[model samples]
Target: MERSYPRDPEWEAMPDVGLEVWPHSPPDTAAYGEARAQALQAPEVEKPFSENLANEALDIPRSQERALSYRVSALMASLARLNHCDDEPTQADMRLIQEQRMLVAMQLAGSPSLQQRLTNPAWVADCWSDALASLGAIGVRVENLPEDCPWDQDALLDGPQPNGRNR
Candidate 1:
């Protein structure tokens, strides 16, 4: 003997109030393929005038170009010193080198022109040579200084002091 399950009479008597469902058909793949093929066959178009002008605006000015060149030179010199030094670098020296590297990295991230300059091997070699020469000159002067000589801070001060007194 099979037992029959009982259903709620009130629920069965209520009208079926359900949303209307629409049947979905597959998209027209043939039409999409035709359109894509047509787009691929289309001729290349030149950039608009305003777009060209915007690109030109991205170029660095001569003054700013020179300033970036100098900063890059200084960074290169600092790196060279860090690599070539016989004695271990002090904490302050390491900090300075790290700062210079970070500064150059940030600058390069912002400017495409500077990034382009770095791509030229000849320019890079020239900058490296200049850095080495500058470092050599500074080293020579530093080596010639007397170790026991006292630093006269007052003599180095040319203008009025922070305490309102004229030096």
Candidate 2:
């Protein structure tokens, strides 16, 4: 007699959604990281010392907003091209772009509202869904996938919060 491991027949063959490959959460993190990277890259406003560093604290955030906007523009273009390609991007390739998309959406949210962030965090679930839905129509689902992404949250928050709070 041969020994066999018992398992749910429906679920036994389901693909593993490891932490790295989880579609939703990881991509969100990556995009925020990249957005932050962009913000930090922002050059100090060319000043003759008259600007007086005009709030270096807030200036840096503006830099980030600019960076995220630029990156998201590029990503949107790339996504459009992917959609029009002679051969649709593979699931793997689509997922990679979807991660970038999630980042942009997160950036769009800007900083967490004073009443937001770790508490009753509604930003991630809804806007993320909207962005992913648009991408999904093109065949790439940004569901629970792993994150191998680069986002820049610090920069994105520099502009304004999506809910119109963090100006």
Candidate 3:
């Protein structure tokens, strides 16, 4: 006689999700609702010093509002390019640039009150010029990736150990 193990046919046929999904209790209704409400109620954080200076520049009244908005857009595009191109900066410097760019973008995009303030031509020009200069100063040369990687340099090991080390 042969011993046999029992298994569920349906379970065996199920497709693999790769992760184990454990059975869990339904979320507590009140707690879940409260958590979502709290998330939604979180306050906006204060802008940093760099952003404050840029905002001040933008706030100065100018006749060419459209041009200033276009300049802001151009600055944002340059920042994105710098980030994508592997121009390495220290983490703190990167953070500052990102913060300033985002604030400028937000002001350009949807903030009517902010947009109203960012009209001065001189200030807007100075703000973007300074930002560009700062970014240019920190950018390092981008290096090209090697055609052959270090891992690929190693030859594959075929079947086994020499010198009485066979497993």
**How many backbone collisions does model 1 have?**
0
Top lDDT hit: 1
Candidate with the larger TM-score of 1 and 2:
1
Q: lDDT tens digits, residues 83-138, model 2?
A: 43455466765565666666755664554322132122243333334444556665
Residue 127, model 1, lDDT? 60
The residue-level lDDT of candidate 2 at 57 comes to 35
TM-score of each: 0.44, 0.34, 0.23
- What value does the lDDT take at residue 130 in candidate 1? 62
Model 3 alpha-carbon drift over 4 Å, by segment: 1-111, 140-167
Q: Once model 2 is optimally superposed onto the true structure by TM-score, how far is the C-alpha of residue 87 displaced, in angstroms?
A: 1.0
Strongest candidate by TM-score? 1
Positional deviation of residue 160's Cα in model 2 after best superposition, in angstroms: 26
How much lDDT does candidate 2 score? Answer: 0.44
**What are the per-residue Cα lDDT tens digits for candidate 1 across 1-167?**
99988998998999755322211321322233333344444455334644443344333234345555666667666644554455566677766656765665565555434555665666565665666667778873333222221112121112111221111
Listed per model in order, the count of residue pairs whose N, CA or C atoms clash below 3 Å is 0, 28, 3
